[model samples]
Target chain A: MTIVITAFERSPDGGKGLARDTRVRWALEEVGQPYEVRLVSFGAMKEPAHLALHPFGQIPTYEERDLGLFETGAIVFHIAERHTGLLPDDANARACAITWMFAALNTVEPPILELVTARIFESDKSWSAQRMPLVEDRVRNRLGQLSRRLGDAEWLDGAFSAGDLMMVSVLLRLRASGLLDEYPNLSAYVARGEARPAYKRAYDAQLAVNKPTAG
Target chain B: MTIVITAFERSPDGGKGLARDTRVRWALEEVGQPYEVRLVSFGAMKEPAHLALHPFGQIPTYEERDLGLFETGAIVFHIAERHTGLLPDDANARACAITWMFAALNTVEPPILELVTARIFESDKSWSAQRMPLVEDRVRNRLGQLSRRLGDAEWLDGAFSAGDLMMVSVLLRLRASGLLDEYPNLSAYVARGEARPAYKRAYDAQLAVNKPTAG
Candidate 1:
């Protein structure tokens, strides 16, 4: 059965690979799965059809035969469970890997998202400058904890499971902010993730869509 | 092997069931698993010993046999996978339910978390009053989409799976903010979750810890 997933017709990031479809694409690439992408314009994403698949009207819904699913974490985890490369065979190790996935999305990403909202949406606010540090500090706090835990480690746990895939993807958004550079080990950690053959393939795939001459 | 989880020595919410341990406890209750709770103070949570178990220094870390795990989503998911109940038998339905769990933590909870930070930490800021509407509107946007999807449904999906367990937990935090009340259906949905026997047991357990006479 062919797997079909949605992507932004044009990502708000302009194909910097920060858009969530890149995460799913990277997971599929990691697992050596060939999947089809159904591009959805921003307007189409909010339409009834897309909303039916993703109630939040988000891009990157997954469909395979009779099954439909959304949420990038779920999509990546589903792909991991179906394939061999992304999860460990050991049950305890696999559960630990899944913990990192949740930590990335829930604990780590929320502060980074608050930073995004501050920079993108609330930049014009009267108190933006003063409040920026508060937002950034919260992000740094999480990164500090994460960096400490990740000391001298290659991946989050043992190998580069979906946990690392997600943690790296979440951290990539921090590059432009320069906060990620504060933690040398985390910067290297994200770089290690980017250096993966699968990550390169996924990055190039999304970049191709945003290239100058691309459709 | 005995299953042990961590909770706050004194929850900030005063045992309103907003602490993340409540979610883990509720999942255990739903699956009829008896577990022990170890309470950690705020300072102790950041200490090396506790941090070894939970990198983020937050409550609700799970330990069983040789495995130690943190992150409420991961813990709840671990319990759901190990035990009966809390998940559907159907593959597609199971995937969809997992999608809702991610949706609650990643999508629905982020804005609500922003609201929490705004109300609690940022309440004293100069821009707090003026900037609240912006933070609030983002939350309302997500809730509106969720409410539309829920419509008259008893749960986000069928049969009250872990997805509803998680989403209801996420939404429960918003009750004090009055934002949840705007969407009657969502409020009712959360109420329905609270009305569950498992949820009540979970809530009462947490409340017992915070009561004046309790140690």
Candidate 2:
């Protein structure tokens, strides 16, 4: 069965590869899986059809045969569980790798997303400037802990499993904010992830979709 | 190997069962597994010892033999995978179950956490009052979609899988906000989760740890 995933018709990031689909596409690339992408407009995303696949009406819903799944973390894990490259063979190492996946999405990403909401949604509000520091500090606190745990390690756990893939992807969101630069190891980690041939392919593919078309 | 997990020494919710450990505890109960709990103070959570187990320095962290794991979702998932009660046997159904878990943490809970931040952390800020409605609306948007998907169904998918456990746990946080009352079906769904024997045992166990000692 062909794996079909949904992506934005035109990503809000404008080809920056920050969209969740990039993460899924990257996972597929790492696992040597060829998948098809269906672009959905923001308006259509909230339609009943899309909502049936994703309760939250979000992009990057995965469909294969009779199975449908959403949530980037879950989709990535689904792909990783079936494919060998994204998970370790050792039981303990695999559990640790899975731990990092949750840590990236649950513990680390929330504060970064709060910063995004503060910047984009609340920028016009009276207290946006004052509140920005508090939000950024929250992100910094998590990053400090993450950097400390990462220490000088090349990847989060052992080799570059899905954990590193997710951690790198989550950290990439901080680059534009300059917070990632404050943590040199994390900066290098993201660079390593970007340098991967598979990551490069996924990045270019998503870019092609979001790029402006000539008249 | 003994399964040990961590919880707040004194939960901010004061035995309200909102702590992540309760979710793990409930899963264990459902699986008919007994476990030990280690209570950690807020200060200790930031220390290197706890940070080594959980980079984010939060509860509950899972330790069994040499393999230690953190992130409530990951820990709960670890337990669910080893045990039978929390997940379906069907491959597609299990994948959907995991998707709902991610949806609970990533999609639904972020806005709710923001609301918590707005109310607890940012309450004194000048923009709290003005910004709250927007935050609440974000939550309502997600809830509306969830309720639509749930319709008259007892759970997100079939049976009370980990997905329902997580979704119910996530939605439980909204009760204090009163946002849950807007959707009657969602309110009933949470009631069903709380009514489960395993959930009651889990809730009571955490309450015992958190309840103040008598003079």
Candidate 3:
């Protein structure tokens, strides 16, 4: 079956590949799967049609044959489960890898997201300056732990898996803030993820849509 | 094999059942699995021993046989996958159910968590009152979409799977804030979850530890 996924018609990040579709695309590329993208404008995303697929009205939603799914964690996990490239053959290893995926999304990403909301949406708020440190510190605390766990390791667990894919994606959001630079190992880990051939392909694919066109 | 999990020595919520461990406990109950709980103090959770089991230094962590897993989502998922009651047999339905789990943690819970930080951690900040509306609105926005999606449905998907288990747990956080009451359907949905036999057992178990005793 041909897989069809959604992406932003024009990403808010303007081709930085922070938009979530890039993550799904990266997963597909890593697994050597060919999929089609259906772009949705911001207005259309909130429409009933998109809402039917994703209750949160976000991209990207996965559609294959009769099946439809959302949530990058779920989408990526589904892809990883069906494909050989992203998960370990050992059951315990696979479970551990999945744990990292959850940690990346629920634990690591939430604080980073708070930081993003502060920097972007709440920048004009009176508390932005004073509250910024608190938000940043929360992120640092998680990163400090993650950095220690990931010390001298090529990936989160053993070889690169969906766990690394997600950890790297979540960490990517921290790159612009320079928080990622504070931990050399994490910075190197992100660099290693970026260096992957599959990640490069996924990044270029989303960049194509997001990049500005010359008149 | 004996199944062992960890919980807070004394939950910060004082038996309100807001801790993540409650979610895992709920999952185990739903699946009819018997488990043991080891309580960890706040200081102990940050120590290297606890950090070894859970890199983020939070609980509860699951250990059974040779497998040790942290992150409530992953632990709950592991339980659901092994048991019949928490997931559907259909592959597509199962995948969709898992999607809701991620949606609850990643999308819905993040904004709620931000609301929590604002209310609890930053309550004394000068801008707390002014900035709260923005944080609350972000949660309200997600809740509005969720309320609409959940309209007239007993669960997010079908048949009270882990999706409902997780979605209900995430929504429960908003009850004290009175935000949940704004959406009658959501409030009822959470009540429905609480009414389940498994959920009741889970609630009572956590309450036993958290409820204060008179001298």
Candidate 4:
């Protein structure tokens, strides 16, 4: 059976591939898997059908044959688990890589998301300006520690496994904010992940969906 | 080799067991594993030694023999992987359960953390009140959908597993916020998780650490 994933019909990012689906796409591309995209409008996402697949009414749900999955971390993990290149053969290394994956989502992404909430959703609020700095500081704190640990290392761990993939994706949210530039190594690390051919393929695919249609 | 984990020397929660270390302690109890706790002061968390164990300078890092791990998600996941009770034996169920784990941390926890940041760190900011509603809405949106899916169901997937453990942990952040009561099912669900023997043991252990003179 063909693998199918849901994406935003019109992404809030205007097709920058920042939508969670992009992560799934990148993973599939990395594993050389062919898949189909099912575009979902914001309204459709909130409806019962989509809610059945994803309780949170979010984009980027994965369905293949009898298996249906939600949560990008889980989807990416599933892809990495079934495929060889995304995870190491060694048990310890694989465990470490999985650790990074969780770290990226659980530790790194929370602050970055806060930055988003402060900047976009709460931008109109009276305290937006003052609150942003605190949010940014929290992001920086996480990044600083992450950068220190990553000091001069190529990837977060032994090799570029799903961990790096997820970490880079989480860090990418900070790119537009310019806060990522503060940590030179972290910035370069994200660039490295983006420079991958698989990432480019995924980026282009989402970008295409984001493009405004010509009259 | 005996497994060792870290906890706050003096928890700010004052024995309420809201500290991150409590989660790790709970996971160990769930797996029926006896582990040692090495309490660290907030000052020590940033030192080189603790930093080596936890890049983010946070609590509840795990170490056994040569393996060292950080991030509560990673540590709990490690325990779940090593122990049988935390994860299901079926492959698909296991994968779905793992998906819930990510959903808890990645999707659900972000907004809850925002509420924390707004109240604790940014409470004095001009936009705090205005920004809070948005964060609360985001959380409610997640919880609403989750409640609908969990409607009349005992657990997220089949039987309770690591996924519920994580989801419960994520939801617990909302306890003080008073938002959890908005959805009766989710409230009851959290209560159910708390009622677990493992969760009680974990909660009591952290509470013990916070007892006066324990340090």
* TM per candidate: 0.99, 0.98, 0.98, 0.97
lDDT of 2 by residue, A1-215 (tens): 89999999999999999999999999999999999999999999989889888878889999999999999999999999999899999999999999899889988999999998888888998888888999999999999989888889999987999999998999899888999999999899899999999999999999999879811
Ten residues in sequence with the least summed lDDT for candidate 3 chain B:
B206-215
lDDT of 4 by residue, B64-156 (tens): 988888888888888999997889988888889999999999988988887887788768866667667777898888898789888988898
**1 or 3, greater by TM-score:** 1
**Top model by lDDT, which number?**
1
The docking category that best describes candidate 1 is high
Sort the candidates on TM-score, descending order. 1, 3, 2, 4
Q: Supply the TM-score for candidate 2.
A: 0.98
Candidate 3, A76-161: lDDT as tens digits:
99999999899999999999999999999999999999999889998987777888888999999999999999989999999999
lDDT of 3 by residue, B21-41 (tens): 999999999888999999999
**Regions of model 2 farther than 4 Å from truth:** none
**Cα RMSD to the true fold for all candidates:** 0.7, 1.2, 1.3, 1.5
lDDT of 2 by residue, B1-215 (tens): 89999999999999999999999999999999999999999999999899888878889999999999999999889999999989999999999999999999888889888888889998898878888899999999989989999999999998999989999999999999999999999999999999999999999999999888811
Worst 10 residues of 4 chain A by lDDT: A125-134
TM-score of chain A in every predicted structure: 0.99, 0.98, 0.98, 0.98
- Global lDDT of each model? 0.95, 0.92, 0.93, 0.89
Alpha carbon deviation, residue A168, candidate 3 (Å):
0.3
- Candidate topping TM-score: 1
How much is A78 displaced in model 1, in angstroms? 0.2
Which has the higher lDDT value, candidate number 2 or candidate number 4? 2
Q: Which tens-of-lDDT digit does each residue in A1-215 have in candidate 4?
A: 79999999999998777899999999999999999999999999989899889988888999998889999999999999998789999877888888899999989999998888678877887777766777788899899999999998889997799999999999998889999999999999999999999999999999888889711
